[model samples]
Target: MLPINIIGYRRIQNRVKSLIKGPLIRKVLVLVSGTVLAQGIQILASPLLTRLYNPTEFGYLSVYISILGMVSVVASLRYDTAITLPKDDKLAANLLVLSLIIAAMMSFLMGAGWYAVGDKLVGYLHAEGLKGYLWLMPLSLFGLGLYQTLSFWALRRKDYKALARTRISQSVGQLAIQTGVGFLQYGQIGLLLGDVFSRMGGGGGLAVQLWKKDLQLLKTVTWKKLAQTAYEYRGFPLIASSSAFINSAGLQIVPLMMVLMYGPEVSGWLLLSQRVIGAPMDLVGQSVGQVYIGEGSPYILEKPRSLMELFYSMAKKLFAWGVIPTAVLAVSAPWLFHFVFGGDWREAGTYVQVLAVTYLLKLVIVPLANTLTMLEKLKWQWFWDIGRFILVVSGLELAYQLRFSALQAVVVYSACLSIGYVSLFVLSAAALKRHVSRSENELSKALMPDPE
Candidate 1:
């Protein structure tokens, strides 16, 4: 006979195993495991990185990353997102090619624009240190674009394992280069190079896999098909891309504004805080989101109630998983920063404390925001993005004008953004409800007897 506690433990373990045995949960586990390993590498390296480099250097690196993000988000004109929508693999292949072509063109245009006016722009932004590194932007944009397109292609194919491998490759490549360069005393440029390397690293592996598995599909791609698909999915570029760019800008602009209002050192503190808090949150959200899209897409129109259940279930899981971490950070961020990252970073922890709730809200909402895309609600998404961008920018500007300190400014920013995210959740839920109602109505009509 077993003791009561021992039997209960065994039962709980069995239940856990059974829960994770589902295909959706299993796929999420694979991506989450990869994300944990990859982000863990960077997270573990942060203390060393903090000691190796100073706040100002990290600040410059943050600015570069912000620029890279703003461009990379729209590099494929968001056609990559549409890659998963088509029923035909051949159509998806054409979207993949179209994305690549758009990326290349965007890269060339960005490089040309930089060459024409990079100097003045750097000077105006008070980012002179970034001038030498701006040349890498176009290259990084192209790599990021390539990786995103391939990632969506893999998502469409339900190739979660391949996607997981690419993440590991990116982390390893980034950590190696960044650490080596830091040891060599390359300053912020090392961080910049490492970031660029990260953008490019996983792309080759994804590209190789794509080529080997879909060479026949690739061969079928043609100019006519590309053009036709481009027209077919024009809303992605015109609306979704615009919305994505605005959202990206809203995110990246914070550090840029920090740099402008304070200095690189101040921005550096914010950057570290974001890196520590935001990165893990984003990776987890994104991992869950990838699985949600792959798992939930088929049920969107056919069984919207199933999709709604999945959405609510994912949101609940994310919220529950987020609570402990958010509380820990809210309570202990300052001490944690001082102890782990040295005294210089205690301020960064303050920023984390102020923004902890915002990050938690973001963790829950961002993953499910894909609901908008899945439902073809691009216009609604666009409106929300614009409004969020306005709220963030105006709120920050108000804080600055009122002579609020950096921490206070972050508080205002966080509060405003939290409101925005709450609105977003409501919007998404309403969209899902509307979808469910319509689905139910259609089913009822179909089941009704003919008047004749």
Candidate 2:
């Protein structure tokens, strides 16, 4: 029994060490470095941006970006997500072309619709100044969709360096444009331009990287295969599209509601607090998710129980990622906001503190989310996202009706959504644990071959 216990412990220890040396962690380091660099640039630029743009400008920009977030999920019909799933490069390339074509059409449709009803949209937002920005949305959407597709392609190929560089380029292009425009008093248009131009820059980088590294794969793409692949992954476009939107809505809805209930200035406060907390979390979570989904999905198909080893390993990593920084930020949010962005942003600090728990929970949940995709649990993900969206929307609305102050509303939103995040973590862990135990039994049988 003592020897058996020692053997079991050693096996677990070896698996953990393997995870450390594995491609996923190495790739995560590269991507996380780039992401941190990009976010660092944004963080450094925030003081100037907050000074130049004002809360009102930021609020309007939030509205624009939130809308973009919601729309961009469906822009490629969600086919880009499947880019990494297919084992065949030709099939993946076909998925890529299909995504681009869908993106182009979506962009054109949006541009035309905006041209038709631009004035009404302006009236609806009560931001008459945003009217001119309407024309830019389609172009921004196109770039956004294309970058997403290319990012997935990069992840599929494990081209972490290129992905990292594009992130830096986006930060550079966006900051350069906004800073130059800040001197001209272009108001929110400056922010919108930064958003669009950053996407363009990132998209351009991705295109170059895709061509440089995966040119042969691209050359293999044929019309017949492209169409067939499109048909094959139709479930992604059909099922994932809505799930993505609903998931996006859970986050974006708060900003939209802020605009209506509290005004753009308040929306701006919400945006900054969210950004200050969310951007770094997203940087880490996104990098982890890309590797986990792209790499781990294959294991689910071949050695699902073994994949649970990877899942537990990632859970440990995510837990390590969540605790310290979040606790520190929760403690220092107010002083950091006031000192960094000036006195006007003191409230945003409070917002950050109030929502820190939600952000921590979010950090824990994001890396595990790719597990659902690996398990082909799209409908369950959709259901989970639906619950989140409802909880968030209802919580915010309830706060508004109760005459809760803006900060209080955010607190309510955070509390309700954290519950959903916990649920997500628990379900994923339970599912993976069962798989791990089952697979360990098999692993033991395989080990018997080693004994005399």
Question: In terms of lDDT, which candidate is strongest?
Answer: 1
Model 2: colliding residue pairs:
none
- Reference-based lDDT, residue 179, model 2: 89
**What does candidate 1's lDDT look like per residue over 355-378, in tens digits?**
999999999999998998899997
In the range 130-155, model 2's lDDT, one tens digit per residue, is: 77789889989999999999999998
Top model by TM-score, which number? 1
Q: Distance from true position, residue 263, model 1, in Å?
A: 1.7
All candidates: TM-score: 0.84, 0.80
- lDDT (Cα atoms) of all candidates against the true structure: 0.88, 0.84
Report the number of clashing residue pairs per model: 0, 0
Error of 1 at 441 (Å): 11
CA displacement after TM-score superposition, residue 64 of candidate 2 (Å): 0.8
